[model samples]
Target: MGETSKRKRKRNVSLTPEDITKVFEKSMERASADIAKLIEAITGGDAMTRLGVELEGMGLDRMQVIRVAKYFGNKPNQLHIHIWNGLNDSYKPDFVKAILEE
Candidate 1:
């Protein structure tokens, strides 16, 4: 019979509380920067208003339109697709859908 060799498993390195906190903070900073870039790219001019109008036309209520506008204005950007993909399946807006289709 051939002898089977035992493989040693590597132990996972445990992170300290401070290390975890630092990691969390860095992650949050990166997320904030990403969101800031998206906002900067989408904001300015009457983009928000245009987004509101489009959303309203798509059957979203005024409040829903406002929330969507505040989150993602009409100024086209590379990140818009990411935002659209991140939306809840049931909440995808027609305006974004058209943009994505194009």
Candidate 2:
């Protein structure tokens, strides 16, 4: 019985590359929708001028700003802290300071 239980536990589920790709694509689509909704909520439908301009003024390049926005968009709470911790140290302090000042 012990050996049978071990064998059952050892069964592995395998995913094909195509399966992985499909899952990834679905996840990306969901994430993109969430980010867009969050941005709209934050900017009140004025994303280009409000959020974009502000982050740009903070000296974050396009990609960095996108990354920051992803954090803000996806995680309105503690999840953002984990994302923030993963940010590069170079701009992290400045970004935090500027945000806090607001």
Local accuracy by lDDT, each model: 0.61, 0.65
Per-residue lDDT tens digits for candidate 1, residues 1-99, read 333332223345789999999999999999999988877565543445554565767786676665566555443563654555456746756555554
lDDT value, residue 41 of candidate 1:
60
Q: Give TM-scores for every candidate, taking all chains together and pairing residue i with residue i.
A: 0.35, 0.37
lDDT digits (tens) for residues 40-86 of candidate 2? 66544453345456667777777777766664655544444444546
Off by over 4 Å in 1: 1-8, 45-102
Clashes of each: 0, 0
Model 1 pairs in collision: none
lDDT of 2 at 38: 83
**Which numbered prediction scores highest in lDDT against the true structure?**
2
